[model samples]
Target: NQTKMFDEKKLDINDEKYSSFGAVLTDDNNFYFTSARNTARKTYGANEQPYLDMYMATYNADGSFSEPTPISDINTKWHDGPAAVTADGNTMYFSGESFKESKQFERDKDNNLKLGQIYLFKATKTDGKWGNIQPLPLNDKTYSTGNPAISADGKTLYFVSNRPGGQGGNDIWKVEVKGNNTYGEPQNLGDKVNTPGNDNFPYLTTEGKLYFSSDGRKGFGALDIFVIDLAKGTEAKNVGLPVNSGQDDFAFSFNDSKEIGFFSSNRTGVDQLYSATPICGVEAIVMVRDANTGKPLASAKVAILDERNNVIETRTADTNGKVTYSVDCDRAYTIQASMSGYENNSFPIAKTHGGEVNVMADLRPIVEIVKEIEVVLNDIFFEFDKSNITKEAAFELDKLVEAMNNNPEMVIMVKAHTDNRGSAQYNMNLSNKRAKATVQYVISKGIA
Candidate 1:
């Protein structure tokens, strides 16, 4: 659908005051966005400047929005606004300035309030109202973690964080939702998606593509919405034109079907919402299989290489021995597929008109005819002092597994060895553990 272009238009929902750039369309047909219009302060003082707050407006059937209503329950007097809601509409995750009521604002030497780093917060809908606000486990007081974007199934949450150990200023991070509010450690999105500049407002589409605005990557404006196909593992590319402009453009969100979407932009000098439509793209499907037997190779490691032969992305073939990635037209690519006991294979894909591109990678089996005391197999390597089977070791073990599968009557012994660095007993024990782990890994791969 990359051939179509979008005609962008600013929504009538703009005001002279500051308006935050995030907006999400919920399943219940209500539009939710961030705005600083509701900053009336009572806790601090009457003259204190009001901060951003989450506002909801009803989406009428005639394409106009009703009067906006600020949700005071979730909004604090400090900073709170736009949020991402789950498909079931039961939970909401949003960004807000860190606060604990007592220590809400920390002032500087001049007694001026120092803005707190934004943190992610969660709230659940009960009886048609959102309450039970809880901070995410990954939220740090020293760093900021806001701009929440939840996956469709609600298992992963992606957000922008200025946390330590980032590629640059405010890199994007994702954490696994381990059910019942527990979360795993946050993982940086890496240098591919992150840049030396600020990258915020991550929006994950239903199709596994991440769309976020970044001033770091090449773009037409200050902050352009660039989409990276998570499944394809390609570099992010700007969405271009009407959706992007010379001003800051970000906070992109799409509907369930992806037919139409909304994004916030400051092209009009004031932050306002705009709608976008998908224009061009193609689904590139790659299939891996055995060259001789024509059997689909499941679990095959597929690496997508660009013109410079740099592996931009890697994917594991599914049970059907197939993986699909979205790509633009007029770009060439190569795919390398490798499995245990097979010669690595590469399939070259040439650029063409926009559409689906099917690639077949046929890997040849590496047969080692042995006449020695034991049928020799390839070597298995492990990390330093670790007994876990690495991906490389697994590939070697696959060769052994395939040999055993081919000759059902053959049984081989595992001769474990260790160097002289460790204590004799300790080294022996570690080597034995490694041997046992290798056997278990083979069994786990269905090689009895």
Candidate 2:
């Protein structure tokens, strides 16, 4: 049930008359969402085309909601919906769009009024009333920006934008929330999270996980919800299956304390809300380092191999010599670390019941040279009459394997000698077997 935690049912709160999406909740069970159904507004003078607006409702204990009403004080003639409130319940950030009053609501080429690009606005709650609405300083009148999500501490704000300097039609961006109602410059989320298509509706959880929607990345629909571990710097992963379908799926909001969340999708041909529960999984972190010097090996290739030695995923170690992968629980995995001048090392991760697993892949440096023999392996002593490899023999042979990898074209011949304590015929046969086994071990390491 990794991505199928919910049955994908449209919320009963949705009205057949209009599109509903972008739902967030307060601790008191009050729901705030976006809807285009409430088109009636006293501010519109004439010929006001219907647009989305923010609505509020009280969620009843019987799984029903009170009659939803638009938050009239915040609605505009143009689109105004989708909002995120701070944990303190004192501040709110929401989407807003309208024809600029500075431009006198001028019309564009299509006889449509020039759009005042969508941007996020903030409002403060004072004496149980929300007012003092103001646009964020980063908003630009030319390019659109919306879909605000604030961190639990209110120190960071994440949103979507179609502004210049983005990798796609719409990309997610974030800015540090400077205290005293100011913000730092906005930063694009980069190519890993942004594509040439739309990416929007970024939601940051208290645990530092980023959940967003993307039409650009590979997904199950036009826009599917995806998540990434901001702390680990992993790639965006689709929250597939029941939560996603062959339609647009976006606007994911979750409350960690309540353990339930809602996301919007158009699977039934109309945008509606769906409840979802978070799924549990395991994360594997592989740290690669030098065995001798104990220094972090940056840019080392780390491959995650399954039980059958099949390569599942490969990643390069960051500057900290660490790479992480989201893996299933109760399954064995192997991590193979390889660097240019180091002997390849493999570490096995045993099956776990489900939790974080840390692996250390310490690689031994390939000894440059010993004598003129071209290959200087460790002293691999064999038993009195045994030809099979032992633990010590295998450990020593790894050096030979390392040497062969360092000099790919170089070749060495295995010559085995037995002590005079054995018969000449028996010694001859024993020597031949030892030589064959030594060659087999070398070949197993992908060397001649």
- Candidate lDDT values, in order: 0.79, 0.81
List, residue by residue over 1-448, the lDDT tens digit for candidate 1. 2333456767777665566569888767778898766545433344343567888887666667898888877887667867999988889998888774336445576876665678788999999799999887777667788999999899999999888889889899899999878999889999889999999899997878898989998778699888888988977878778788899999998875535688998887767888775555666788889888889999999988777667778999999899787766678888878787676656888986555688988877756533355655556677767788886577567667776776667777786777778899998888998999988987897777
For model 2, how does the per-residue alpha-carbon lDDT over 99-128 read when each residue is reduced to its tens digit? 523552334768755545777788998887
Candidate 2: give its CA RMSD in angstroms. 8.1
Task: Tell me the lDDT of model 2 at 64.
Answer: 72
List runs of model 1 lying over 4 Å from the truth. Answer: 1-5, 39-50, 60-62, 100-107, 110-115, 280-448
Global local distance difference test of model 1 = 0.79
Write out the backbone clash pairs for model 1.
Answer: 1-279, 1-280, 2-279, 2-280, 2-281, 3-280, 39-50
Alpha carbon lDDT of residue 375, candidate 1? Answer: 55
Please give the TM-score that candidate 2 achieves against the real structure.
0.64
Report each candidate's C-alpha RMSD, comma-separated, in the order given. 18.9, 8.1
Worst 10 residues of 2 by lDDT: 41-50
